[model samples]
Target: MSKSKKSEFRPNDYVVYPAHGVGQIVSIEKQEVVGIELELFVISFEKDKMTLRVPTNKATEIGMRGLSSPDVISKAMTTLKGKAKVKRAMWSRRAQEYEQKINSGDLIAIAEVVRDLHRTDDQREQSYSERQLYEAALERLTREVAAVNGADEVAAAKQVGDVLISRAAAA
Candidate 1:
């Protein structure tokens, strides 16, 4: 009761899907969903479960985007290790802005979150919410890095984490 479309994805392509960070074009396939045509791309991650997707053109503008360039990813990774302003403003206010940056899917905006929320090793563990938000930002950032670098998601995440951890210790 459904039709499948030929996939237009190739290996090592970089893509960003707002909340999910960046993922490579792992594979594409067609499946039936409610008696309608559905295409999907299979994406892998080191930190999270693998994900599936359809064509970008057919998607409601989500899923399966090429990863960012190495230079761009580098900037984000480096930026995260830099000093940033931690607004003394109430968290509710800052959180709103953080949410905005994560959703923007712009590497720099996401980087800001990573930089601001980053906790040093000497610092006490982050609050539950802070850790949650940091993971979210890291995942998003790592996804892009993994996709672009052709590295596993977990490795990419560790790379970013190591940098942040070291930066915090030094500060």
Candidate 2:
């Protein structure tokens, strides 16, 4: 039915795809694949210099979703202010878990990665792998926050950093 074929996203709408960060829906197109026609949502990730086409009906199943709501964003900010929870597992195991959280495209989960891996100046330096994961999580979180708040990446990063720093000071 025509109603069933309608898309939830419009061109220029920002969306988050799991395994990727924020992207814009550039267009919707019908393309012939093999013998059948398929409707796809063309999404562009400007920062990553990438574009992806996803079947409209499968988008939700693939975990593609709209930007976080203001309440969700607020909760993520509160999450940042919470104490970090680092498991006693080995570094490699923890690294795998951190990577999974970052790629999951859940803002709150990504915030957990950022918080758990964050190290203050007085703390010992992170291993190369740890630093890489932290930056990745921070970047993902910053991009989403920037998109949601209508601010630039730098300002978003600073806002998140300020929250973490304040948490550190409180502890």
Candidate 3:
């Protein structure tokens, strides 16, 4: 790509930032530092009330990406329907891994977190931190799925919840 070309993201375009969940590209900004000009993509996360500015050249390197394709979302849904994989590691270690996967900006990894932490009827309750992580992953996954499907977050969440509930029932 050439520097003069337009960025892949545009204003009002929803994007996924690795550390954050769903954000919209607000605008492109140009700044001068050390007499060098830099263009930045300003993203806003309404749910988090946070704004992130990423350099145009560093966007991909930092794992900023557009919404997932339908095929990828289908795969993630499939992942949700599959059995959860709870590792034998300690809770602290597993929590760390879960947090890492949530921040990795990968849909399937986030799905795994949701699947593992999900509580079925008559199942044991989750630890506070486990619930926190589960909610975080669920929010992240649901936001993308919502954006892709043009549905509200609650409905999207229900859709995902239905998958989990049915899977647990079958298992």
lDDT comparing candidate 3 with the true structure: 0.91
Give the candidate number with the greatest lDDT.
2
Candidate 2 per-residue lDDT, tens place, 51-153, comes to 9999998888788899999898889989989998999999989999999999898999999998888899999989999999999999999999999999999
Which runs of model 3 end up more than 4 angstroms from their true locations? 1-6
lDDT of each: 0.72, 0.92, 0.91
Q: After superposition, how far is residue 15 of candidate 3 from its true place, in Å?
A: 0.8
lDDT of 1 by residue, 65-123 (tens): 45567888888878988897789999889888888888878887888898998876666
Highest TM-score: give the candidate number: 2
lDDT of 2: 0.92
Instruction: Please list the Cα RMSD from the true structure of every candidate, rounded to 1 decimal place.
Output: 5.2, 2.0, 1.7
TM-score of each model, in listed order: 0.70, 0.95, 0.94
The residue pairs in collision within model 3 are: none
Q: TM-score ranking from best to worst?
A: 2, 3, 1
